[model samples]
Target: MARFICGADRHQVTLLPNRLDDYVSEDNPVRVVDLFVDELDLTALGFASMMPAATGRPGYHPATLLKLYLYGYVNQVTSSRRLEREAGRNVELMWLTGRLAPDFKTIADFRRDNGPAIQAASRQFVVLCRQLGLLAGGVVALDGSRFKAVNTRDRNFTPAAVRRRIEQIEASIARYLAALDTADRQEDEVAHVRKVRIAERLDALRTRMRELQAMESLVEAAPDRQISLTDPDARAMATRGKGTGMVGYNVQAVVDTEHHLIVAHEVTNVGHDRTQLAHMSRQGQVATGHEALSVLADRGYFSGEEIL
Candidate 1:
C-alpha cells in the first residue's frame, strides 16, 4: 500500500515558537507600503485626527490605518469588510498593522473623509517613480474605460427609455385585462378567482404606469434627458458589444510607456473619449514635468479639434 508523507497530529504540541514576521519575506511589497506610510507626515498631508484626542479614549494611529489601506490597495482588497477580515487572518496585513484590527466602518470612513489626502499620496508615488528615472522616455499612452457605477440599469432612464418602459407596462396591462375578460366569460369558480387576481394585477400595473409617466415627464424636462436614481453623476454609456450598455462613469488614464506607471487619471460622466485627448495629454505633460510630451491613444480618441 502507498503511504503519503506523515502529517502532524492535530492534538500534538511542539516547543517551536512561531512569529508573524518570520512568515513575511525581506523583499515583500507590504514592507514597501509600510515604509512609505512611515515616511509620510500624515498631519501635513491634511489627514485629520492624526493625534489622539487627549481627553477621550485613544484611537488607532492614522499610520496604522494608512498602512492597512495601502496594503489592501496593492493586494486588491479594497473593500472595508474584506480588509477587516484580512486583518484577523492575513499574515502580511497582521504584520503591517501590528495585529491591530480596526472595524470596517472605521476603515471606510478614513477613505471617505480623506479623499484629497489619498490623491496626494498617489501623486507622491508618481513623484518617486520620476525620481527613479521611470518617466525618462516622456512618451505616454492615454485610454478610457467605463467603470460600473453604483446605479443599476433599472434605476437609470433616458427620456426614450422611460417612454419605452411605459409602453411595455401598458402592453402588460392590456394582456392582463384580456385574461380577466376570458376568465369572466368562463363562469367557473377557479376562473372567478383568477379574474379577481388579474384585476388586482391590472390595478397595480396602472399605478406603476402612472409613476412611469411621471418619471418620463421629469426625464424629458432634464437638461441631459437622462436620470440615474442611485448616482446622480453616472450616465448611460455604450460598451464594445452591440446592444450592450451600462450606467457608469468614464475613467481616463495616461500611463508612462517605459515603466507603465500611471501618470494622470480622471473620472468623468462623459461617455465618449473624443474630448479627453487634449485634457489627458495636458495632464500627462504636467505629471511628467516635461515641456513637451508625445501622447498615444486608440482610435476612439480621434478628434481634430482636440488634436489641434
Candidate 2:
C-alpha cells in the first residue's frame, strides 16, 4: 500500500461497473470475427445442428461457436482445451462468446463433426480477403509444415523399421534362451523362479514378433511402405534435424507475401515439398483470382517434373 500511484482497493466496490465493450477498442480484430461470422448462413455453409431438434436441450448458437472458432484460429489458439480456458478468462473471448463458455468436448466435437463446413467457411474468408484488397499482390509464397498426429513412434512402422525390430527381437530371444539354459542347470528354487521369468519374457517376445510379422505384410502392401496404427493417414516425415522425423501430415499453404494471409491450403500424407509447385501455384491463382500468379518457394520445392 505504498503511495507510489496506488491501485484501487481490493475490496472496493464501484457503483458503475466497467463494460466489456469499454475494454475492447474500435479497431480490435474480435469485432471483425463477429461481423464476418454474423454474415454467414450456417445452414448453407453445411454446418450441422443449425436447427435445434425438438427432443433435445438447446445448444450454443452456431454463430456464437463460429465466432469463437474464428477468434481462436486468427489468434493461433487452436487447441480446444486452450480455447475453453480462454473463454473463461480472456476478455476478448468473453466479449466474442457473450460470456458463454462451452466445454472442451463441445468445442472439439464441433470441429470434428464440421470439417466440410469449416473448409467452406475458410474459402469464403479468403474470398472476402481478396475483395477487401488485402490480397492485392499477384505473388505468393508456398511452404509446407508437418503437423504431428496422435500416433506415437512405436506404433508407426516403416519397412526398414520393421526389419530392424524383428532382428532385435531375435537377438533378445537368443539371449533369453541362453540364460534359461543356465538357469535349468542350477539346483535351487531361485533358479526355478528365474526359469519361469525367462519363459514369460520369451512368450511376450514371441507374441510381439508374430504381431510384427502380420504388420510387415501391411507395410509392404502400403504405397509408402509404412503404416501408422493409431492414425492411419499419418506418414513418417523427416524434419530439418538430422535423423529426426515425425508421423504426421504435410500441410501446404500458399500465402500472400504482402499481407501474409493464407490464400489456399491443402493437407496430404506426402512428406516432401518437392512436387507441390504446380498444384499450389494453380491454387494460388484460383484463390487470388489472378491468372498470372507468381509462386516462390525454397530449393526443396525444386522438381523438374513439377516445373515442367
lDDT of each: 0.90, 0.92
Task: Give a tens-digit lDDT track for model 2, residues 1-308.
Answer: 57678878889987764788887889999999989898988899999888898887789987888888889998999999999999999999999888999999999999999999989999999999999999989999999988999998888999988999999999999999999999999999999999999999999999999999999999999887988989999999888798688889999999999999999999999999898899989999999999888898999899999999
Clashes of 1: 0
The alpha-carbon RMSD values of the candidates against the true structure, listed in the order shown, are 2.3, 1.5
RMSD of 2: 1.5
lDDT by residue for model 1 over 1-308, one digit each (tens)?
25868878989978763788887899999989998888888888888788677797888888898889888888889799999999999988889998999999999999998988888888888888888889999799999988999999899999878888888998998899889879989977999889889989988999998889889888889899899999999999988898689999999999999888888999999989999999999989988998889898999999999999
Instruction: TM-score each candidate.
Output: 0.91, 0.96
Query: Which segments of candidate 2 are over 4 A away from where they belong?
Result: 1-7, 15-18
- The top-ranked prediction according to lDDT is 2
TM-score: model 2 vs. ground truth? 0.96
In model 1, which regions exceed 4 Å deviation?
A: 1-19, 55-57
